[model samples]
Target: MKRFFMLAFLVGLIVSGFAFKVIMVTDIGGLGDGSFMDGTWAGIVKAAEEYGLEYEVIQSKEQSDYIPNLSKAAEEADVVFAVGFLMSDAFFKVAQQYPATYFVGIDFSFPEEKNLPNVMTFTFKEQEGSFLTGYLAAGMTRTGKVAILGGIPIPPVQRYVIGFEAGVKAYNQIHKTNIKVKSVYANTFTDPKKGKEFGQALISEGYDIIQQACGGTALGLLEAIKEENQKRANIDNLPEFIDDLYKNGGVFMLGGDIEQEWQAPGHILASAIKRVDVASYLGVVKAYTGEWEPGNVELGIKEKGEGISRMPFTKGLVSNKLLAEIVYIQNLVGIGKIKIPSTEEELKAFWLKGIEIPF
Candidate 1:
């Protein structure tokens, strides 16, 4: 009996040894925000099922949790993925200690360092997707006025804003339209109060649709839009806080970084998605399967790694003619026929072409 028990134990150990171990440390927003971390988790779960990998996830409650989480994962995991730009410093510190364990940093870039051979930094061309959203907003707006709200001026955030404005100008010039756009920077990524405040301010200024580029701040923007809905039912004069001097119905919000259309259903028109899931998934698969490559991997509209999502909420809401035009543009942009502007000069030239907004 003793000999049989020992043999069974040995067989179990052998089976467990085949499982690849992965540990993930998520951003401050944690698992339930229905955004990047959630998307990454979905992909990880798929990999876990397919590859028989043992995996664990740790949520960072604050920025301070980053380094500790990284260190913990490095000690146990064959490969560890650190999500978000907020964790960059933490990752750098942990990487120095765990020189043997592989590290994947999503939405981050690092100076080339041969000594940190185990660290792979992945950054996305979010502006590419933002450009599509901007073009669509320009084409669809009926008020001849649109706006953008950015959480902060970080390179990633700034790129989205720049690219979006450029796309708007491109479509406007092609159609010979003049649509005014107002942009505001909230200067903070996590505060919903500032997002909502800026959103209300934009609406009062005659901006009808505002694209929000902050994380939690975007959620606040949505809240402000909802408040606009409540106010529109009451009076012609909008509050000073929400000084919109024009347009009849409530204002709308567009989300960035993730598929945020579901956040407020009808309130959020579309989302410029950065495919954090695909990025995370690819990283895990590469590491697990021995296909991992160092250096930068950029995903954009051309690569199908990022794009805007216009789900059914827009059906019947946007005019058929406008929808058709957007579809045509989408195909063109996707196929490289319509080169969406990625620079300030490119955007200005596109708008100079004078393509007008449908509204």
Candidate 2:
């Protein structure tokens, strides 16, 4: 994943936001790749239009570029947005160096008792949203096998993995069916070739559904799915609906960080929606109004920060009944009746305690 350089973009913000300067430093995925970075940039773009703000984007090509990109942004920006959890360490270093600059870190985690006067970070309950995708994958798989693919084995990515597996297990417990889940990691977010290779191999191995949590690496996985679907499409009657697709050996993918359902359409069942855009937009609002404070905020389903998306691409193809079940589970999670796990111990306890089906 790589972000391309862009000329500074200006849009009309709200009255208070009209005079602010904002800059965003993308994670390794950069922009596009149909995931997280895209969502972050969308927030900046939206804030610009709604608040009359001037913004610039600095795309980090690799891990080493984080400090430099952040440093460059803080030099001029009234507020600097560090757009990934991977940049947490680098973000803090930059924030300290430029104490006058206010910094907002999206998907940033705060280590124990670590707070800065000039920094605020937003962390999402990615596990909660990811749980829904896991359930969807389990419910839709005809082959009884699904997979979770991550760009790296970091805690954030692990949260997605944990929640997904817990969801699949929850489904299995409720339905009395045995579904297998596999977790794979790319160790790097930038390699689409490796991602595509993993996708094809997993598909061949009979894991019919794969949930992609990786950033740009997922681009290759999507490409793999398209290729597989094409190979399978040369049949008498290709299935137009999800059930038909499942029955005909077609594969599905669920994604995270943004709406990637449109990336592969039918092949991509849905994406667990994380409102990184909302977090970014609000960060600017707070900074512009001088309400900015050093703190960590965790937004989840209850806060409208994370959830499953409405199936727009798959539309009529996805079953209404299945969609209902997903929403039911999502609502349960949103209401705190269904506590999805974010760690190994909790996931273990979750399975033992069982998921509550909100009918």
lDDT of 1 by residue, 145-173 (tens): 88888876776777788877876776666
Candidate 2 residue pairs that clash = 1-190, 12-52, 13-50, 13-51, 13-52, 14-50, 14-51
Per-residue CA lDDT of model 2 for 176-221, tens digit only, reads 8899999999887888999999999999999988999898998899
- What ranges in model 1 sit over 4 Å off? 1-5, 114-116, 230-249, 337-359
Clashes of each: 14, 7
Best by lDDT: 2
Top TM-score prediction, candidate number: 2
- Judged by lDDT against the true structure, how good is candidate 1? 0.74
What does candidate 2 score on TM? 0.90
